[model samples]
Target: MKSQLFTIAIAAFVASLSYARSYANEAKSEQRMNVLFLASDDLNSWLLGDTNRYAGKVVAPNLTKLAESGVNFKRAYTAAPVCSPSRTAFFSGVAPWTSGHYHNTPGANSSEPLKSALSMAGFFKKAGYSTAGYGKITHGWDQGEHWDEKIGHKRDPAPPGAPLTPSGRGEQDWGPIHLAEEEMNDTLNVDNAIHRLQQEHDKPFFIACGTFNPHMPWYVPQKYFDMFPLDEVTTPELREDDLDDVPEWGVELTLGKQKYVDSVFEHGLHKEGVQAYLATTAYADAQLGRVLDALDKSPYRDNTVVVFLTDHGFHLAEKHHWQKATLWEEATHTLMMIRAPGVTPAGGAACERFVSLLDIYPTLAELCGLEPPDYLDGRSLVPLLRNPEAEWQSTAITGLTSKGGPTWHPYLSIRSETGRYIRYVDGQEEFYDTSKDPHEWTNSIGDPEYASVIKRMRAAIPSPSDAATPLPEVLKNTRE
Candidate 1:
């Protein structure tokens, strides 16, 4: 009987050990690096450091803190400048030229059918990661349908119409408030993120929180506006002869947005627009701080990775432009800040490699130890992130062509480390020695001295692939 008892005890001990092993494995899987992807609407690189010279225009203490803890990429770009196509390239890891996604519509109309694409979210979900996409996941995808849970009833509905404010058309306000009053609304989105965080999910989370502030009609609490006095707000250096050397193409691109950017020429409107952008940015920064604060107070603080970016840069009366969709430096560049513990070098390590939104997929894939699919157009920026002084520098490309525009020359821009090359497909080109002329006042495209540099920059264009694929058979048979 003693021997029998001994055997039973051994068996019990083995079972206990097995159970402990299973629990440990489960914890490891559950502890995958949760992501807090904070995207801004049309935010540019200039607004981050004193780089844009306007960082002080807004008091974004939270973003400043976040940057203190993370790495802010000084030179980051978008594959395309337009919203839909650029956003599409962000997910597909390729350019719109190849995907047949020229404009916001076409294949990526508001209603799309790709339930499963090479999107980062789809990729993460497939790898046992629980995804939560809130507010503007991408330009093409059904943002609500894409996430496991959405913020509002539908993914992209205007919140229950609140008491509408006056057509505060000309100037920027602190927002969600009025000209006189300084009320605020933080619960709309930041609270939603916190609520999602509180929920219990077995899989690690990939939360994308995109803020629509500072996009247009910049709205924030008047409190934020009070932070930036109008007279103190620094404006873009407005030169009278800014466009003298700019070609017809560049001039056209700059002046085209005159209609949409309504507040540019209004009385002290430029100041308000700048103030509004800063106020909206500061407000968004506060909203982000809430998320970061929550993460710090939660069980997932040390293990989570945070990525903040903007779709593209917004133009506030600069060069007479309001929004993006241009191939200029302001429009082509984006705001990219990442905070991944143990992965990203902290304390404002600036990386100047020519990278686009397309790099996001491979970078995340490498960081998380996942195998990226074969069809992605961008390569992993892991090596560069590891070594800030990475040597392999290539130029990033952005294209611009409106369906109804008079000038048929597709605006193509190549932003390199040393200089910039902008050309219309029809042969008109502008070359700016960014090393010397950062303001891009001089056009040296046809200059004999810079002939070789121009040739090299032009050849940097990605070799045509299936993107150069011929048109559909039905189109071939259609009458012109």
Candidate 2:
């Protein structure tokens, strides 16, 4: 009887050991999924396949192809209209208002509250993943410690050309350069990213490639410019009275940057400027294609989760605006696409639900089976990835501080599927029934019929106390 009992105990111990080994193997497999983050600067949603009017007008075959493979968000918006604040929101999983990173102030990661938070890269690094960043990931913030390897502020040589217009906005100038595509900064960045992908790694990798093209100065190769002829190039539909219904503060914001509009018209470079923007966009697209192709040929393509997005949208003479920093659709709406290896549905579907750049952090964390920090203000997008038609109730909020002195208040815009509502700090409001007026030409805030809609949208805006303190006067009035 003693021998039989000893034998039974040995069998139970062996079974327990097998279970432990199985669990360890499963965990390792879970950790092996890689993340490839691709970012663009100042890329508007209208330049891609999101809108019917611009569809097939822009030359972005790779982006279109990538969209076909995964889920594209049709109505993704940035937390803020500028670079630093928008990127800060995504990286920290916190909104600009909550973090008080409303301006182009760099080193936001070192700020209060966010100083203790685990950045997107930091969180992945802590989870046994190798992280590397290239190009302009953060707006001038030195996040060198967050990555295992980092290449910061890489830029391409200025295109070899003369001034098209004496606007003095050197970076805003656009022309064709004489340099080869391979010699461009974006190409070099992609080359480095591809090299990393080709190497075998002991741990999964989180590679970030931020391309800085089409951002400003629109200088690219002549071939790209040739793609869009001066005569055939189409500009965003503009109405002379588009801003007629805008509030006084909103009008002030537009008038503050009237110089750019004046310059564009004064030099007869409107179509040329549009052409340059298109050329730069194409150049960015080519760089994207190269990087994506490298990944496809690499061994880890199947196990990687690819996310592509722009920092924020750009305004190419839309609403009489020349650049970003507006709550209008042209400035806040951006391009967001995710190609999660297993979670996303096949055939490149699109989710029209209103989503924010802030959601990217939590969505990526959840996709990799990691628990996102509790302080995140955005919701996980896993449900939408699983089913594009998933029931979702969310609105995208974008904020901008007016261009006045220290006394100016910030304006917040809440974007829903049906309409967009803007509430100024002084209680002045603007509402657009987007279902009828897609361009927001008319502000219907005074209409009694939509009082309930205004009430609902107003309720969504976070209280002023939850927002970060107003940026100092020195940091105010600066253009993005």
Regions of model 2 farther than 4 Å from truth: 1-29, 49-56, 106-110, 160-162, 166-168, 403-408, 468-480
- Candidate 1 off by > 4 Å: 1-31, 53-56, 105-116, 142-146, 152-187, 259-263, 346-348, 403-410, 463-480
Model 1: per-residue Cα lDDT over 1-480, one tens digit each: 999999998998899578546634654564567788777776666556544534445576776677667766667788777677777777656455444454564445422213224677777777778888666557754434446765531222222233122324333222445432212333356677877777776777888777666565565566877888888987776656666777776777667566544444544466666776777777777777887788778777777788787777766666667677777777887877777776667554767677777777877776666677755666777666666676666667776665433222356678887578877755678898877776666778777988888898887754323343433321222212
RMSD of each: 11.8, 9.3
Worst 10 residues of 1 by lDDT: 152-161
**What TM-score would every model get versus the actual structure?**
0.81, 0.88
Candidate 1 Cα lDDT to native: 0.65
Task: Give residue 287's error in model 1 in angstroms.
Answer: 0.8
The sequence of per-residue lDDT tens digits that candidate 2 reaches over residues 86-182 is: 8878887767666666657434654464655568998899888999988777774445687988876566666545564566375667676767888
Candidate closest to the true structure, highest TM-score: 2
Please count the clashing residue pairs in each candidate, in the order shown.
Answer: 6, 2
